[model samples]
Target: MSKVVFITGASSGIGKSIGLYLHGKNYKVYGTSRNPSKVNVPFSMVALDVTQKESIKRAIGEVIGIEGKIDVLINNAGKGITGPIEDTPTEEMKFNFDTNFFGVIDVIKEVLPSMRLEKSGLIINTTSIAGYMGLPFRGVYSASKGALELVTEALSMEVKSFGVRVVNVAPGDFATNIAAGRYHTPVFENSAYKEKYAENLALMDSHVSSGEDPMMMAKAIYEIIKSKSPKIHYKVGGFMEKFSIILKRVLPDKIYEKLLMNHYKL
Candidate 1:
């Protein structure tokens, strides 16, 4: 039987691109979206809101029922929220975790039973370089991804003996819907962080607008899954992320912060 892969947030962006890439590679693909009507991908479509456990449960159940086996589970459904930490609402921060962190956990928990029963599977959590370096106004988004990065590391160890693998894909900056409403800072009222916000938003917007094609990320993900043993974490995208990673390691903290501020025109 052909192997099957289940992907969340497959309606568009990198998730959708990954689904298409894998499908074209001959894997039976199951794609999920909150609005199934908006998903026009050639793969199977099911309604799923990653923020809701029930939605994830139902979607996975459907995939298992039809495919009888899930060789891979890609937790690609996520969003971004950018603003001063103080200006970010309590509910907004919670919503970010609800969708980006806990949502992936819910899907993993729902799918793992079958994976363990079969004694094999691969899990991919789509994260960002933000997981490593917390951006100025992306506290919530970074925190959510940071949480996932920790989960990915610890869970990889936890599941290694079970013949299941957990990995994280941290893309630097890519053209995707993840930045649709969140990357840009809103004009704040009485906000003392306005200059910082403006500078960060401008940097984020420029990087996102000119970032690597989503296809590069999708292809990288495909290659990882095809490997006999995937790494615990892989960084995608290009030079910007690579440079950030190196700078975070070599530069003094104060110097790095200064460089980032100047580079972003803050």
Candidate 2:
């Protein structure tokens, strides 16, 4: 029997690419969008809003009803927030965490029961290289992905004995529709960070616009699903972005901080 795969945020970008790639490989894929009627994917589409528990429950139930079991669950529904730490409102930070962190948790909770009952499953989370080191203007976005990465690490150990595996796929900048979906906090005309915010926001967008194809990430995900024992974390992106992970681990705190600042032109 073909393994069943479920993915969130599949209306476009990385999530949509992965759903199509896996379905073409005969994985029996189901993808979700906040508005199912708007999704134009070939695979089955489910209406899911991960931040809401009831929506998550309904989506998971629908999948289970048709597939009997979910062999792989991809938590890819997330958006980015940009602003200086002090200028970012509390509500905005909460909104970032709602979709990036808590939403992932809610969906995982709903699917784990079924995965645990079957004694086998794979949970692949989409994290980012920014999660490793807090970015200057995008601190809130960084914090959310960083939190998810830690949860993925801890969850892997907690469910290892149940024949379940959890892993985080941290990609660097990718050419996707993330820019269109990104949320920017309100900035006052006289705010201290006004100038820097404008500069950094453009820089971030440019980097993402010139990033590698989203299909690269889809290929990496496909490989992970085929593996019998995948690593707890996989970094997928350009050479520098992948190497930065190593640099952060081996370099001293102060030195690494300097390098990070220099790289972002802070």
Candidate 3:
């Protein structure tokens, strides 16, 4: 039987790339979007809002009703935020977690029973390289993805006996519309972080604009799906981007902080 794959946030960007690529490979692919009718794609795009629990339930139920089981679940639906921790609204960070962290968990919970029943499943979480460190002006975004990474670790072991595998795929940066959709706290003229926040905001967007192709991530996902024993974490990105994770492990804490500060020109 062709494997059934369900992905969230498939309306655009990396999620869309994964869906289309998997569809071309003859896998049964179903993706999610808040407004399915707004976009057109070769694979199925169901109505889903990660922030809403009922929506997640309904979407997964729809897929399972037809396919009877999901072989792979890609948690790709997420939002981004950029600003100084102090300057950014607290509510904004909470909302970001609602989508990026909590929403992913809820979706996994909904799919786990079916996966466990079938005695096999793969869960690929879309995390970020930023999650490995607290970057300047992107602290909130970093925290959310970091939390998801930790949960993936915990869940992977917890579900091992059930034959359900959970892993994180952290991408450094990829050219996408995430920049335009990100919640950017304004650089208030009187705020202490005004100048630095504005400058870093632009830097964040530029990285996305010049980042690697989304198909790279899509290809990585496909490989993971086919693996017999996939690793706990898989990172996809440029040389420096993936190397940064290694540097974090070997470098002194203070030196690593300095390197990031210099890179961001802080």
Q: Pick the candidate with the highest TM-score.
A: 3
Q: Is candidate 2 or candidate 3 better by TM-score?
A: 3
Candidate with top lDDT is 3
Q: Which has the higher TM-score value, candidate number 1 or candidate number 3?
A: 3
C-alpha lDDT of all candidate models, in order? 0.86, 0.93, 0.95
Task: State the lDDT at 83 in candidate 1.
Answer: 87
| Cα misplacement distance, residue 116 of candidate 2 (Å) | 1.1
Deviation of model 1 at 4, angstroms: 0.7
List the candidates' TM-scores in order.
0.95, 0.98, 0.99
Clashes of 2: 0
Regions more than 4 Å wrong, model 1: 183-185
Task: Count the clashes in each prediction.
Answer: 0, 0, 0
Ranking by TM-score: 3, 2, 1
Per-residue lDDT for 77-173 in model 1, tens only? 8888888888878888888898999999989999998999999999999998888877778878889999999998999998888899999999888
Q: Worst lDDT window (10 residues) for model 3?
A: 193-202
For residue 148, give model 1's deviation from the true position in Å: 0.5
Clashing pairs in 3: none
C-alpha RMSD of candidate 1: 1.4
